[model samples]
Target: MGGSGFLGGELVRRSVMDGRVVAATYLSRPGAAAGADWLPLDVRDRTAVAALIGEFGPDIVVNAAFRQSDWVTTAMGAAHVAVATSENGGRLVHVSSDAVFSGKAVTYTENCVPDPITPYGAAKAAAETAVQAIDPTAVIARTSLIVGDGGSPHEDLVRSLATGGRNGVLFTDDVRCPVHVRDLSAALLELANSDRAGIHHVAGADAVSRYELGCLIARRDGFDPARLPFGRRADTDLPGPVDVRLDCGLTQRHLRTRLRGAREFVK
Candidate 1:
């Protein structure tokens, strides 16, 4: 539903490139989605969600709208979208995050139970539970750090760290399987068109530490990787490194689409 955001924007662009009739939804920004039919939607408002869904009567709905600061928009709003999509008999592909899992596990399968350690993780877990309860046929695609050609928030943050725009150390111990934006968007579109229901891990093919990812980006983008210092979770009082390495073998086998790793896209 968030056509303005990174992954959402890519979906819109790719849909248009594929010659699909697209109606994108935005929360506060209108011009964020350049092409396609733009619709102002506040998912937190249940009535607004229903009205939009009824009028549009979309065949497939992808819930990409999320906010970390606002629980109402992130969790409850997802629930609203799921319920509305279910009521309309529309196929739903909800975007979830790897944050739903605790870092205790080295690798997480699709069947891994969610045990979030952070508030954002907890909210995402709640959203997944709510979506499944409301619509059993909904596809919950849990992804890791999203990176691509166009600037994403995660990529921007890494750039800031490399350029000294942001004063934060990258974690060397933290591990994640970052999926390219195009690959992820394509996978979501495929799942949206299919009848596949239940949780699925749609992430990168390779796992790497956050420090390695940041350094890769810095070197590729002509920034000094040495400017970015590394932070060890074991040495600090802060919450330790989280290893959200998802096993995307099921996704690789299910769909013909190939999920490229961060190494391929960093450059």
Candidate 2:
């Protein structure tokens, strides 16, 4: 689902390239990617979700639709998808987030239980719980910040800051293990086709702060890295994790796709 989104669009593109029959879901408008059936779906509607998945009868379903601030869409919508997928007898791969963890653990493994400090994190945690309960065989892939060539929100922010289009400071204390969208999409497909069940951590190899990440993007995009203003997350009243990193060691050992770090990919 969410074929119009950045990560979702990549998934649809790759799946179509592989000659798979694809049916991608969007909210408002269809994505630019061709060769896939673009269907309008509001995951918040349980009946609509069930009807669509039932009619499609896909062998594998990947739920990537979410709104960070909407509990109904992020948490309850996931549950709806899980239920529908389970009833349709299809393999499910639900995308989750690292926000489920507080920075108290610093680095988290697949075994780590979610202790979210923010509303978004709590919603993600709730989604994970519901998916696991509904479909024990489902693959719940928890990924970190998803960066792409020049399409991701972070990349856009970097360009805006560097070109004086926006005013903001990249947080030096806010650290995360960001994964490339292509790598993450490929990994999700691999897991979807495999028998891998339960939670899996799919993230980049390197953990860096947001400021460091912005600098890397600036350098790659032909901008002066020094011009990117930086600040400490600790100095702000922001309610989120400071240094949450996902340890993808165990999951990496099982995948053929090499998850590239931000430094290498941006450069």
Candidate 3:
């Protein structure tokens, strides 16, 4: 529903390219993505969500709307969308995050119980629980850090750190499986058109440390890698790093699409 966001924009572009009629929702930032009808939506409002779904009557409702700083919008909003979509008899493909797990395990499968350590992760985990309870058939695709040709939040943070615009230390211990925006978007659309339901791990094939990711991004973007300082979560006196590595084998087996690694697309 977040047509202006990176992933949402990519999905809209791909949907239009495939000649599908697309209607997207935006909040504060108006979406400039072409070939899609845009509408203002406050997903936090249950009545508004139901009304919007009734107006659109979309065969598949994709809830890509999220705000990191706003839990009401990110967590409860997902529940509202799920319940509304379920009542309307529409398939729901809710985009989720890998942060839903604690970094305790080496790798996570779709069946892994959520044990979030961060506030954002907790919110995501709660959203997943609510969605499943309200709509058991909805496809909850939990993905990791998203990157691609078009700049994303992850790339923006890396660029800021690499160029010394933002003074922050990259954690060598924190690891994540980052997926390309286009690849994930295409896979979401495929799932939207299919009957697959339940949780799916849609992420990159490789997992890399945040420190390594910053260095690779710096080298690829013509920035000084030396400017990015590497630090450990333990040394920083912060909570332990949320090192999540998703097992996307099930996703790969279920879909024909191949999600590539960060190293393959950074250049």
Error of 2 at 169 (Å): 0.5
CA error at residue 225 for candidate 3, angstroms: 1.8
Report the lDDT tens digits of candidate 3 across residue range 1-267: 888889998998898999988989999866778999988999999899999998888888889998876889889999999988998899999999988888888699999999887787888888999999999899999999898864887788888887778888888888999899998998998898888999999999889988888888889889888999889876766653357899999988988789898888777
Clashing pairs in 3: none
Give me the runs in candidate 3 sitting further than 4 Å from their true place: 239-241
Error of 3 at 48 (Å): 0.6
TM-score of each: 0.95, 0.99, 0.95
Cand. 3 TM to true fold: 0.95
Show model 2 residue runs off by greater than 4 Å: none
The lDDT of each candidate is 0.88, 0.96, 0.88
Q: Report the lDDT tens digits of candidate 1 across residue range 139-254.
A: 99999999886387767877898878888887888899999999999999998878689999999987988899988888887889899878977667865337779999987788
Best by TM-score: 2
- Backbone clash pairs for candidate 2 read none
**Model 2 lDDT, residue 266, Cα:** 85
